[model samples]
Target: MSKFGFLKVAAAIPHVRIADCDYNARQITGLIRKGADRGARIILFPELSVTAYTCGDLIQQPTLLNAAEQALGYILSETSQLPVVGIVGMPITYGNALYNCAVVFAEGRIRGVVPKTYIPNYAEFYEARCFMSGEEIGFATIRMCGQETDFGRNILFNLDGVKFGVEICEDMWVPAAPSVNQAVDGAQVLFNLSASPEVIGKHNYLLSLVKSQSARTQSAYVYCSAGYGESSTDLVFAGNGIIVEGGQILQRSERFSLEEQLVVADIDTERLITSRRRTTTFAPHRPNERIIVEISLPKNPADTTLDRWIDPQPFVPGSPEEMEECGNEIVNIQTMGLAQRLEHTNCKKVVLGVSGGLDSTLALMIAVRTFDRLGLNRKGIIAVTMPGFGTSNRTYRNALALMRCLGVTSREISIRKACEQHFADIGLDPTTQSSAYENAQARERTQILMDLANLEGGLVLGTGDLSELALGWATYNGDQMSMYGLNASLPKTLIRVLMRWMAERCKDDAIRQILIDVVETPISPELLPTEEGKEFGQQTEKIIGPYELHDFFLYHFIHNGYSPAKILFVAQKAFNDRYDRGTILRWMRLFFQRFFSQQFKRSTMPDGPKVGIISLSPRGDWRMPSDANADTWMREIDRLIEEEK
Candidate 1:
C-alpha cells in the first residue's frame, strides 16, 4: 500500500452543551470515531468545543477549567485506538491567565496545543475580559491531566508528511492571519475551529473569505464552526462546516442543523505542494519561534475514490441558463476578436473555406456577426464551400442553406478535378484512396482560399477548433494553415453547444432551421470519398476518438498538468456510465500520443484569441519545442495497460 499524496480530512460540527464538559467530550469523541471510520486522517472540531464557546465567564472559574481538562483526557483516551489526528477546542491556563486554544492529539497522547492568536474584543465578542491572546507567548508546557504538553500558536503538526497548522474563530477574519505565516512556513493544510454567529448575510462573506484565503495561501483549509447546541441568548450559531482545497470548496454542511454535522473530503496535498513549488512569487521565510511535531498516521493506500464532482464538460457550463449565457459570451468574444482584426487591418473582405462541418459553420457564423458588428457589407464575408470526395448531402445542403439564409455571398469549387490532376502530376495513383489522396484535397482547398483572399484583398479565416488542433487531426499546410483562426481556443464539445444555442436564439426562421440541422450533423473532415450513393463516410470521431474524451484529456493535460495515470483514473469515474475502461484507455493513449507528436503543428499555429483556460496559442499560453520526446509518457501508459491486464 503506497501512502503519499492525498490526505483525507474532516470538518466536524459537534452538538455542544454550555459548561457541560463531559457531554461535549462525548460528542466530540463520537465525531472523531466517525471520521476515522470514514478514513479521515485529520478531523477538526469547532472553537472551545470542550466547554462550548458560549460558556462565557464560566471559563474563568477553576472548576469549569478543571472539568474541561479532564474531558480532554477522556477524549484522548477514547480516541486512542483510532488511527486519526483530532483537533478540538478548549480553554487552557498557562500562568495567571486563561487562553482559548485548540488541542491537537492522536493515539491517546496530546501532541500539542495551539492557542488562539487574535482574541476578538469588539462587536459581540469580549474575549479580552476572560481570555488572553497567544501573541505574547512563544512556546510553553502546561500540565493537562498530569501530562505536560507542548503549547503555542506557532506549532505545526507534521503527520505522515502532511503539515497542518491551527487558527481559531477570529484568526481568519483579520487582515494578516496567523494562517498566512503558518502556510509560508510550510503548512499544507490550515485548520480553523470557528464559533462565528450567523447574521443576515455573513455566510457569503465568510465563504468568500475562505476561498480567497485558500487561493492566496495556496493551501487546503478545513473550517468547522459551532453548531445549534450553544447558548442563543444574544446570537444563533448556524454550524457551517466547510472543507476547501486550493480555493475550491469540496464539502459544506447545512446551516442551523440540530444534529452533529461531519463533512469529509479528500484534499489533494500533492497538488498544493506542486503549486507552491512552481509559483516563483511564494517566498517562505523560516520563523524561529515555530515548532514542528513529527507524528505518524496509519500507512494506508492512497485513496483515488473521489466524493466530489468530476464534471464531464469542464469548459462548458452545467446549467441551462449558464450554458446559454456562456454561448452568448463565447460568440461575443469570437465576434469581437475578429472585429478587432478586421478594423485594424482595414481589409477589403474576409475569406473562409466552409466545409459544412461544425468548425467551418461556426467560423462562417462568426464572420457574419463580425461583419455586422463592424457595419461592413455582408458580401465582403465570402463563404466558399469546397466539395471534395467525402462531402455528404446533409452537411452540403446545410452549409449552402446557412450561407444563403444569412445573406452572405456564397460560391462552390469542387476539388475532385484539381486533386486528380495533382495526383497525375505527382505520379501517385488517383484510383487509390490513401493519405496522399486525402491530403491533396485539403492542400488544394487551402491554396484556393489563400489565392482568393489575396485577389479579393481579404484575410483567410481559419476554421479548425481546439480539439482538432490538440489532437493534430489537421493536415499540415492544408486545413491546418490559416491567416487568423477564430475557433482555435474552443473545444469540440463546446462548439456543439454554441451551434445549438445559435439555432434556438436566431430570430430568422430559415437560419435557425439550417443551424439546427447543422448541430445534428455528424462531425467529419470530408477527406475520403463516399460510397456510390450514400453519405460521406469519413467521420472524425470514428477515425480519432470521441471529442468529449479528447477535450477532457486536453483540459486535464494542459490546464492541470495531470499525469497519465491520474487522468485515466478520474476519466473512469467521470465516464463510467458512458464508456468502458478499455475504450477510455485506448482513446487516452491515442490522445497523449497525438498531443506530444503534434507539438510541431501547434508550435507554428496561427494567432487566435484565447477565450478560456485551455488554449494552445503557441506565443501566448503554450510554448513547446517541436522535438520534445514522449518516451516517459508512453512508458507510463504501457504500465497502466499492464496493470489493467
Candidate 2:
C-alpha cells in the first residue's frame, strides 16, 4: 500500500494530560485538522483518550466522567469543519451501564459509536468494577447536531466505495477479535483504538500481531495507541501509531516519546477487491449477531491527491538487519532447491554458461555452493564460456578468471564459428539475418551446454532470471529451457544488487573483482554485433526501461493485482524526483503489454524455487491463462497517460 493503493488512512497519536479533558480535546482536534489538511479521509485516535489512559482511579469519579462526556460532544462539533471521519474513545452510558466505546465523527456530526465488547477484568484493569459488557443492541439512532447518528459496529461507513468498521482497545489482542466479526459484516478498514502499556521488548511483538492480522483479514488496519501522557504510576505508554495494509506495517512511530505521532498509509481498495475476488475464502458475513448501520458518507472528489508515503525500495523490507536476513533466506532457498534437484538426478556435476553477468554469476555461485554441500569436487562443476557476436573482451576475460578463481573446470567456445556453420546448414546469409540470426547463436550455445552436460553426466543450469522470464526476453528452448533454474525468481534489479553485495562480502579476490565489474557493466542481451566503436552492445534498458523501475512495477502489478492506472499513479509518486511521469507511463505501458503477451512463456517455465511472496513460477506461485488479452490493460494505460498530460 505504501507504493500503490487507493485507501488513505492515518493513525494520529496526540499528546494528552492525565484527567484533563479540555487539554486532550484541543490536542486531538489539532491532529484531526492536520490529517484533514494532508488529505487523509479517515483518522483514528487512542482508546479512552478523552481523559487519558493513566487516569485509572480517576475514571471512577463522577467529575472526570462528566468532563469526558462534555469533551466528546465538543470534539464531534469542532471536527465537522474537516472532510474526514475520526474515531475517539470514551465511556458511554447505555441501559444503566457504562461501557467503553469509540465514537466515530464526520463532517461536524456524530456518525457512529462502537462499544468495546471484551473488557479486561484481569490484571490491573478494573474495568469490571466500572463498566459492563456490550449488551445485544440494534442499530439505534441517536441525536447528534439535530440529526440521527448510527450507533454500533454493525455500522459500515461507505465513503465513495470504501466500507470501514471500528474496534476498541483490547479488541484486537483477544482470541476472536471484534474486527473479525466486523470484517465478516463487510468492513474494509478496521480502526482499532488502543491504550496498551509499553513493556520491555513488547513493541516488536505488537508490530507482528498488527501486521499478521491485517494480512489474515485482507483489510486496512489503523492502530492508534496512547502515547506519553498516560499514567506512569504503574505503567508506561509509547505513543504507538501504525498504519498497515495487507501484511506489512507501512509506517510506525517512534517508541516511548512524549510527543504526538502521526503515520499515514494508503490502502488500495481496488487491489483489495481483486484479492478478495481471487481469494475464494473472502465472502459476506453470516455471523451469529450483527448490527446494520448504513451511515452517510463523504463525496468522492474527482482529483484526490493521495498524500501518502511511498517506499523507495518496494521488494526489500525496511531496516538494514531485516534486509540482510531476507537476502540470506532467499539465497538459501535457491541453493537448497538446486541441491535437492541434483540429488534426485544423482548428478555429480552441474554445467552452466558463465558470462560474468549477474544471472550467470549467481547461477555459478549456487552451483559451486551446491557441489560443496554434497562434498563433490569443485572441478566436477563444468563452467562453459561462450563468446558470441557481442561478447566484449572485458566480459570474456572476466568469465575465465571467475572459473579459475573458484577452482572449477572451465571451457571457452567461440559461438561465431559455431553459428557460421549453423547459418550455412540452414541456407541463411551471415549478413542478412533476422530473429533467426539472433536465435541461432543462442541455440548453438544451449546445444553446447546440454551436450557438455551429457558428456559429463551433469545438469544444465539455467541462468535466465525472473525479469527475463516475465517479459519473454529469453531465447525460447535455448536459454529459457533448463533442467534446473537457479535464478528464475531473482529480478534484474535485485540480481545486480545481490551480486554487488556478494562481491563486497566474498573473500575470493578474483571472483569479487569480476562481480564488481559485471555489476558496473551495461545490461545487454548480446544479440547485436559489436562491429564498430560501441562500448556495450544491445543494452536491455534501452528497450525495457530501467530494471529498478520495472522491478518496482512488477512488485505492484502481480503482487497486488494493481491496475495500470494505479500503477502509473504510484510510479510517479515513488519516482517523482528520479523519473518524470511521461517516462514512467511509457514503461508502465510496456510492462502491461509485455506481461500480458508473455504469459505463454511463464506458463512453461522451468522448475525454480519460490523465494519471495511474489513470484512467476508456474509450478508454484503463478498460474496464468496464456490467452489473456492485453486490450483492456493497454487501453487503461493509454487513457491514464493521456489524462495526465
Candidate 3:
C-alpha cells in the first residue's frame, strides 16, 4: 500500500509569544499539515508547544488555560482532515487539578490526554506550583471535543500497527523512567514532550540519556523539546529533537535553528517484538494498570517519501577527531581484556593457527600486542601453519612467512595425509566430499591446535569471528572450540578493514608486508579441495553474501531493533548503488535464518570481550534459547517480501 513498509514522524519547534493562543494555533496547524504532507504518521511537538512552556505562574490563570484548550480544539479541527497522529502540549484543569499534559489527536477527533507523572519543581523548572503530577495509576476520563477520553501514562495508543506510549520531559531524566515501565507493560514506542533548556555540555548528556533509555527499554523514543521560542530570559532552549531506537540515535535536529525544525523517523514494530521475544529479562508485565487504544493511521503506512538521509557509515564515528579517540579506546579495551585472561591462566605462550585471513590475522596481531604488554618473548607465541587438502600456496606461504617474520615459534604441518588417514579410519572415501569432508578437515585442524596447546602449555587462541558464530559457519568442536577467541567480538567486515589499518601503521616492515598480503587475500577456510586442481580455495563470500552487507544487516537487526521490513528499508537506502532491494531481502532472510539457527554455537562459546553494543557471547549481552524456533521470524520476512511484490 506504500512505497516502503515504514512511516515518517516529525518533531516541530515553533516560535510564538506566550498567552497568544491565536498565533500559536495557526502555527500548530501549519506544522501539522506540513508533517502530514511529508508522510508523517505521528508528529510530536515540544512540551507546552501549543501556547508556550515558559508561561510560569500564568499557567494557573483560568483564561490562559482555557485559551490553550480552545487553541487545541481549533488546531485539531483544521489538521484532523489529514491522517496524522499529533501530540500537542498544554496546561489543563480537570477535577480540582491543573496538569501539564500531552493531548492526543487522530482521525479527525481528540482521542486521549496523558498528564505528566513527575512535575519538576527544581532549579529552573517549577511545574509543581501550577500543575499536579498524574502519578496515581488509575483510569480517569476527561472532556475532549464534547466527549470523554482516557488519560494516564498507562494509556497506550496504537497507530501504524505499533503500540505507542507517552511520558513528559522530566519523567525521562529519572533513573527509572515512566517509559521503562510502559515498555515492560507492552509499549513499543515512547514519545516525550519536553521543554528542557540548553546548558554547556547538556546536548551530549541529553542525547546519551535518549540512547540509553531507548536501549534499556527496547523501544523507539521520539524526544521533542521546546526551542528558542520558549522564553530565554534566564536560560536558552535548543529544541533538542532526537529519534532513537535500541541504543543508536537515528535522527537529531539542528540545534539553535531559528526556523521551525522537524526531525522524523519510523519505529519498527517487528524489530521491537523480535528483540523482546529473545530477551527474557524484557518480560512483559501482566494485565495490570495498562490501557490499549487502537488509533487509526493512514492507509499508506509505508509511504516514506521523507527528506531523511541514511548515514552510510553508521558504526564509524561521524567526526575524524572522534573516530581516532574511539579507535584508541576500543583497542585498549580489547588488549586489556586479553591481557587479564592470559594473566589469570598464567599462560606463558599462546598457540594460534595462521590462515593469512582477517580473523586469524587480527587475533595474531592482538596476541603480539598482548605479549608486548606482558613483557613476554614473542617466541613464546607459537604461530602454526597447517596446510590442509584445500590449502593454496599463496595462503600457505603468507602464513609461514608471517610467523617467521614475527620471530614466533613456527611449525608447518601438512594435513593432507592426516585427513586421508582420518577418512580411512572413519570408513569413508576421501574423494566423497560433503559436510563431513569439510568438517573433518576443520576438526582435524582444531585437534592439532588443541594437542599442540596442551603439549606446549599454551592457550589456543581462536580466530573465528562474530559473523561466523552468528551464522554457525564453523564446524562444531572445530573452529567453534577454543580456549579464548580473541576476535570473537569483532565482526568480519570490521576486522578486514582493521587488519588493513594495522598493517599500514605497523613499525615492523616484515610484519607489515605479511599483514597487507593477508588483507588482499581472498577469504576462505581451505576446507574444500582447490577448484579442479587450480589455485585458491572456496570463497566464503561466494557462499555467504559480502561481510559488509552482513555486518550492516547484523547491526541493524541486533542493535537498532530494526524490523526485517525496516532492515530492508534502510539496507536499500544504504546499499542501493551496490545491492538491489531483492538482493538485500535475499541476504537479509539468510541473516535472520542463520542468526536464529546458530544460537547453539554461541551458547557454549569461548570467553571473549564485548567491544561493541552487540555481542554473541552467551554469558554476556545475549542469552537466547538454543532450541528456539525461527519460524515466526522467517514468517515475518516472507510476509514482507510477499507484500513487496
Q: Pick the candidate with the highest TM-score.
A: 1
lDDT of 1 by residue, 569-644 (tens): 7788799999988888899899989988998889888888898767898887788878888889889888988888
lDDT of each: 0.87, 0.80, 0.82
The all-Cα superposition gives candidate 1 an RMSD in Å to the true structure of 2.3
Sort every candidate by TM-score, greatest first. Answer: 1, 2, 3
lDDT of 3: 0.82
- Which ranges in model 1 have alpha carbons more than 4 Å from their true place? 1-4, 283-289, 300-304
Q: Tell me, by lDDT, which candidate is best.
A: 1
Clashes of 2: 6
Q: Model 1: which ten-residue window has the lowest total lDDT? A: 299-308
lDDT of 2 by residue, 206-317 (tens): 8888888788888878898998878788888878888887876777888877678777766777766677777777785466455554445454342167645666557665
Clashes of each: 0, 6, 0
Q: What's model 3's TM-score?
A: 0.82
- Regarding TM-score, does 1 or 2 come out ahead? 1
